[model samples]
Target: MDNLVKKVKEGIWSGRTDHLENKESFRYHQIVELAQLDTLDTEGKACVIIGFESDEGVRRNKGQIGAAKAPNELRSELAKLPWHVSSEKYVVDIGTIDCTGNDLEKAQQQLGDVVNQVLTKKMTPIILGGGHETAYGHYLGVRNYIGKAAKLGIINIDAHFDLRPYDEQPSSGTMFRQILEQDENSSYFVLGIQRYGNTQALFDKADELGVIYICEEDMHGEQLVQVNKAIEEFFQNNDFIMLTLCTDVLNAAFAPGVSASSPFGLSPNTVRSIIRIVSSNEKTLSFDISEVNPLLDENNRTVKLGAYLVNEAITSFLN
Candidate 1:
């Protein structure tokens, strides 16, 4: 047994497994330059990747362990993605977080720790996977760090407003609800929300909370103007912006691995255009892509696509 474990560690795995053969390996790939311990005094740039798999406990039971596997899978795929930006010049530390526990509060607290650590280093947190519910913790960290210094803006691309009543405690489907409760004055906008999934109650809540939602039918047919206008408005008010891309906002054909696969979503080109526009803006402090469940994916396509989106955003910064 010891020999088998040693061979797996030295051969198949990178010798960083949690146990002998039961746990997943670390999900980080430091393609860029590695920093020395002495450099701790300096503020370094980095993009943090995190995975949270307690979907069942969080009340988002779409992809099970697939959510937990996203950060590592996306990193593996990113290693192969051809970045349009030069590797050496663009030095970004890849900090991958592991959220293996089943407690939602505990998982969220752990995520909050990573967020604080990244912002402290003057690095933007480009997190991946876990669940949309993780956004609450992310926002908590942002509020704690920024602390009245900068007005915050939230740009969410999703198929649902996720503004369900704060009654059921808050899950992946209620992150924005918690977000609004925390900072109702913060500028928040939702793009590509399917008209069918959102309840009238949510629309009313959004209106009351000053949250903007651009529905799918409206965006695809006649609401393009509104979508563009909302983007402009969000930036005009808040200097610090966090953009979140929920894979379910894309049509199931493009992102079938999401927890709740929806048909009426933005096209790949449209989403890319949005990302490009946002990335080009100077206000964007950080970006995140969630709901990339590898288990539901047909052939690792979702992971690859998510990686491509990240690559495009990183490249856009160069342009």
Candidate 2:
């Protein structure tokens, strides 16, 4: 694990300032850094951000290849944002887990170890992703920390169900399926599933696996009341909740940097509301935003949106 992980480079915080008298003063880069993932001091902190800098699973899944570049891009953007809150305790940059020689499984295992380390200390783990594959790795860590029988529920905001079979080897498209196959106790509820994005076989697989999902239309229409009710019930049944947001779930105009952008996708406003609702609940444990591919992006829109979502979640978790 040590071989795969590296401390966040010092220069990532270059834009920091000490002008405390300024009304909109502090920024993210000003937050403290941890020497290592396990060395974090969670005394006055909301969460620690850890990056997974690998996209090999995307390559295996035959998606766009550039998602591997997302984590650093996210950090570069997140570091520049001003921290509006007035507290000394802030998020810690716990560095990243890089996949060397395209060894995806080892990287995910390393990630799982890091997530377990974070959980035991009672601090939230905010995993900045390499791909949707990060979701599976994040799940392994959560399951490891809470146990397979811990009544953990996963809330995924994605355009596709990502429950494709992994008979051979798992890839970005088969993470949720991998999770379900590994743990029958898994309860997953996917929101923002695009009707056009997934095939009928995948939908059948979701049903076969007893997965809960709401298509994009169902999430936006009057059915939202029922959707919230379902989500509330799911939350009540679970001891802990893990959240994952796939950038491709947003409309292309809002998140063009994703591996696959949706023309008819959920609005960022709607997604933020969901994040607020989910994070506000004390049961939510860990979170990650995945599938940001800047090589395909216009400007830095997707990564900025990813930072905003992380900030929103942290603020909700803190307050």
Candidate 3:
């Protein structure tokens, strides 16, 4: 273990490779370096990527367990990104957070540790995922740092609202519900939600809770400008914002490796556009991208797209 940790450290700081390459078993290894809690700017701000591998809820679906390997797959692709983009320095001190044996309690605690450290230094935390159920953990990190009374909020870009009732036990689908229930003033705006998969029960809960829901069909033909406007409105009153990108938000053609592959959703271009608009705003406190099941991926397409999203996050931050 000592020798392995030494070797991993050497590779991360070696600077020969533009990015670090990783895999499922090796994926968590990359995260150990990421969780070092260092690498912040003089102002103590940095972007942290926490990639988790637990898929407890997805165990029921054979295809979903494969998503556990996504973060490792994404590392390889992200390393190849060009350094010089439009003269702004894309200096992301990337790292990962290890998942805790699919234990939600331990996982959230670990997540809270990294998130608290980042926020304490005033750095942004860009979390990758174990599952969207991590929203609860991620939000705990935010609310812990900013305090719940500060009007904390989240922005989800995906095909489902994920507001299933607490009785069902939280999955990727029930994270948003758990988040909103944390506080009534805690606002959550979900974009690109497909009208189909969401049960009437979920919709009713959203309506009663006053969670903002934007259907994919309604936004399908609309310009990126229109979508950005709505996002801006939802975020206008919030003090701290957590951004979530569920791969299912990308049209199946672009992101087919997800557990819940849906027919209709935003094009990669639209996803890019939304990411740019939301991330560029200084209000963003932390972010996460979830549900890229590399096992189901074709030619590593989903990993490449996940890498692309990281690039967009850096570019958006710098711009």
Best by TM-score: 2
Question: Pairing residues by index, what is the TM-score of model 3?
Answer: 0.84
Q: Rate the local accuracy (lDDT) of all candidates.
A: 0.65, 0.85, 0.68
Candidates sorted by lDDT, best first:
2, 3, 1
Task: After the best TM-score superposition of candidate 3, give how far the Cα of residue 154 lies from its true spot, in angstroms.
Answer: 0.8
Error of 3 at 162 (Å): 1.0
> What tens-digit string does per-residue lDDT give for candidate 3 at 62-136?
336766676666666765555433322324434545554656656666667667766787767776665666566
Tens digits of per-residue lDDT for model 1 on 1-319?
1110011111211223333332132222323333322242333334444344445423443334456667667666765543344333343433444455546766676666656655666756666666777677677667767776678898888888878765745567778877777774577888887878777887888898888777777766455666777788888998678788888888888888877788777887778878887877877766777878888997887888888887766666544
Give the poorly placed runs of model 3, Cα more than 4 Å off: 1-35, 38-45, 60-63, 85-95
Least well predicted 10-residue stretch by lDDT in candidate 1: 1-10
- Give the higher-lDDT candidate: 1 or 2: 2
Candidate 2 collision pairs: none
Per-prediction backbone clash count: 1, 0, 5
RMSD of each: 7.6, 1.8, 5.7
- What local lDDT does model 3 show for residue 145? 90
